[model samples]
Target: MRSRSAPPTVRDVAARAGVSPGTVSKALNGTGQLRAATRDRVAAAAEELGFRPNHLAKSLLEGRTYTVGILTSDSFGRFTTPVMVGIEDALGAGRMSTLLCDGRGDPLRERHYVQELLNRRVDGLVVTGRRPDPRPSLGRLPIPVVYVLVQSDDPEDLSLTYDDVQGAALATEHLVASGRKRFAHVSGPERHWSTQRRREGVGRALEAADLPLAPELVLLGQWSEAWGRTAAAQLLRRDSGVDAVVCGSDQIARGVADGLREAGADVPGRVAVVGFDNWDVMVEAARPPLTTVDPNLTALGQHAATRLMDAIDGKELPRGVHRQPCDLVVRQSSV
Candidate 1:
């Protein structure tokens, strides 16, 4: 029934509620001191009038756009997608929108996107994946920046990353409890945080069991099936005594199992295999199923969003590297 010539505004809402525009603003922004009953009246009237605030005008007055920027590497990666979904859901609940920028592992492209987001006046920023160190000057930006699934050079910067250390520990401990003592590791890139944490976790478990890892038993390479094949081949050829294998990822574990089968090794009979990143699609179809750790990336993303919102709300957050817990799923591969 309303005319299309002019859309409803704060003034319209105020007029409908029998209050001043200032009172309407206070109730909507939750800033100025306003009685709860009066605020409810203003909100109800605004809803009835179908009044949506002029975001640009409100931002101009408050010097904030209430927008958050999310920077991700390889936006289509399986692991990154769930985390992003969590961020989106949390931000939406907070009544904020996100601008996503995919770096695709390009430093120059990342820098450009950061600059663009800043120019658009995003109130906060969240960067994902391992990036070339953010420019030292990024600290000077007026908005808060948080890192997810990656480590940043700035110690003070907020980061929520996968607890790879705990993930590795759980995998290794499971193998040990399954009565497999002789162990080997098929690892990813040496410089990767995941690879490093996994290695450390394995070592801790071994140390706790009063066992020492043989240098030849540790196979370090990339997060690829090809590397898994090569590492599995060499490991079996050199030491046929290994009773278990801990793979850096589900992909790597698949290749390792394939190679072991070709070499006539009885999976879970003579050797148990455990991997990281349950990576459900590939894992569900893997032969003999895979015992792997679930990084809980979705939960990690949600946590990051919650943390960022807390910071925005001026709430005291216990700041440090927060590592989300990982779950070890049992399956045929390690049975």
Candidate 2:
């Protein structure tokens, strides 16, 4: 047995794997070709001996800092938290560390953080915004970049956002399956691209089911519960015979549920309510658990990290926006 005073080294791992130090180095660094069995044996031997590579030497040899940076305009808010976790998970497997910078939507602060990250020599960057709207790119930088949960307006930069149209279409399809005919949409600001896409989705689904497009029943409001409550009241006042309502977010859905119940409508019976972004806190707390569309934010981040890593490795990837699919979660609100 080796003494606790000394750490296991590559030489020890090579001895156990029955390979020379040169071969061990190649196997660990993933450099020269080696038989799969030899690589597996060396890996197992290293794991058993608790052998770790000399990162300093590895960095010197590979000319990489083995670190990545994520810059978000949200200041690490709720929406960006899971994305960061996913990024870390993917980068860690590649022996890379992560650095996160929050701009809080300040242009000066964003520039400052960008410079800071560059000074630290991160291998690449991942950029995101609070919303799915497109924002100006970070311009051509020395490192590669991938955008997630948001997009860079520049056509040359790689960007990713959820398929809002598909998500909303699924939500509407569920409501239709539940026997809802007359429908209303309560969503965020009319200016938001997400809201516009969701509205289009709802319209398309309604058309597909041979249902009325009831554009008059749709209400454009803030992305908050207050707007939801107000819109619900307005919807009831119209006496439009609306049997189903689709919302842009869980917050709005929760408020709509409250308003409708207070105004004497049977949730999921007299009316079905479906929401987007299946946010747990707002959804679960709603009178009936809110059925919602999940954006799979973590998965989006994971894919973004993979794209950035590929770019760093000199792989050619297509630029422009890539749409990630979303899922609809059913609950009492939309059963």
Candidate 3:
């Protein structure tokens, strides 16, 4: 029988390439200073020898776990899933793994999870929440911390949040340009930053069009479809002259459209409707494809990861809220 061959080691590759083990390590781990020619040689030798570094041993030497921590207010939320996918894809491309923790919207639990991540010596941290608030304690952590889909408490902290103001402006402008003068708004939770920004954008757009926002036409409620239905019914009952309805979210828009249809109103023909948060699959599958704002949640996650990675590499990122742009996806709902 043939003798079993021993697994290749970093030492074998370094020797074969005529370079020190340290140089080979630096080239493989994407760290340290090594000449291009030497790095290439080591890489070629490693491939030939089938050398794979022991990750545990490497972590021990570098004092880095090569793991990132992600904390979300609600892991099962529709918006959180796609954003997490984007974050994971970006981090995986960098050869990093993630440890996810769900806070369930509890501040105490969030604080506890942060401490646990720190204790594990995570390479970086990502925090996701609906509300934007200053995070003074995060700055004290030794590793980099990034806020995603939320604003940080401190103005100087790094964050990646959706451009709700721009999204709402685009939606409202589209309606105004299309000759819809009498506009109404169906909003989400009053306390949400996204809700406030979106409402502000709509208000600004209406003001620019020289049309005052009719207070009776504005309806504020939760982010649920039920709330949208109720609000839409109430608005229609109270204001029969409204030509359009701007929704804070796609889910709310869906409800509004349903309510209108039930009331014998033809969407886009009688009353045009627009909403934020693209929600492609869900919104696209609707009978009348919904016109909504694509918040680019995936891009938001990827940008946050990139920023955190740069900070880890000793790069200086400009501090403050980093707003990612939103695109309006036109569909049948808005015509």
Candidate 4:
């Protein structure tokens, strides 16, 4: 066994494998031509001796830092948390560490974070946002960058975001499959791109089924539980015959659920409900589990990390928006 004072080195591995130190280096890095048997022997000897390479030394020698910086508008927000998890998971597998900075949606804070990351010499950068709206570009930088759940106004940058329209369509189709005929939509403000896309999705789904999304039945309000309650009350008063309501968010769906019970309607029996953003807390804690559309935020983060890595490795990446697909999660509220 090797001494406990220190870890085994390349020389010890070469001696154990009966090869020259230079030959061992070649085999380990796959740089020089070597016989297959010699390479295998060197690998086995290194494994038996528990030899670990100094990645920091190797990174310095190669003139690259194996670190990335991630700038997020709201790190504590539910939507951003899962995406950050995904980015970390992917980067760790590639032997890369990350520096996270929260800008809290302030331009000055964002600029400061960017300068700090650049000073640290990060190999790459990833910018994440809670919403999927377009923002001012970060401008040119020494390192490659990729945007997550948000788009850069600069056409030269790359971005990865969810297909909100597809997600909403999935939720609407599920509700339709549950034998719902009369339907209504309660969503966030019309100014948000997500809200606009999801509202369009609802209309498209109904159109495909030979139905119509009556303007009077659609309520545009805040992305909050309070709005959900208010909209549900007004919707029920206007049309108590509504069989299902598609909400913009899970929080809203929870309020709608409470409003339905208060209005003397049986959930899933008389009025089905569906929501967007499958946030587990809100979905599982509802009176009856809520059915919702998942934006696949984790997958979006993973894709963004992968793209940045590719760019770092001298691969030419296409600039523009990349859309990731979303799916539906069924629960008691919508069959």
Best of the candidates, lDDT = 4
Measured over all alpha carbons after superposition, the RMSD of each candidate to the real structure, in angstroms, is 3.5, 2.3, 3.0, 2.5
Clashes of each: 0, 0, 3, 0
Give the Å error, residue 59, model 1: 3.4
- Residue pairs whose backbone atoms clash in candidate 1: none
In model 3, the Cα lDDT at residue 183 comes to 90
- What does candidate 2's lDDT look like per residue over 1-335, in tens digits? 87887989888999999999999998988879899999999999999998989998888888898999888888647789888878888887887898888888787898999999999889899998778988888899999988898889899998988999999999999999888888999999999999999999999999999998666788998988988888989998885588899998888999899989888998988889999998889999899899999999888888988888898999975799999989998999987
Better of 2 and 3 by lDDT: 2
Q: Give the TM-score of candidate 1.
A: 0.83
Error of 4 at 123 (Å): 0.8
Runs with alpha carbons beyond 4 Å of true place in candidate 1: 1-54, 130-137, 316-320
Which residues of candidate 2, in runs, are more than 4 Å off? 1-6, 35-37
| Per-candidate local distance difference test | 0.82, 0.89, 0.84, 0.90
Between candidates 3 and 4, name the one with more favorable TM-score: 4
* Candidate 2 Cα lDDT to native: 0.89
Q: Which model scores highest in TM-score? A: 2
lDDT of model 4 at residue 47? Answer: 98
| lDDT tens per residue, model 1, 1-335 | 65677899888899999999999989987868888999999999999988888888877987778899988885666766888888988998878899989888777888899999989988888888642223222454566777888766666777778778888989999988888888899998787767787999999988898776888899998878778878888998889899899998998998888788778888879888888898887577777689999988888888888888887777754544677789999999999
Model 1 poorest 10 in a row by lDDT: 130-139
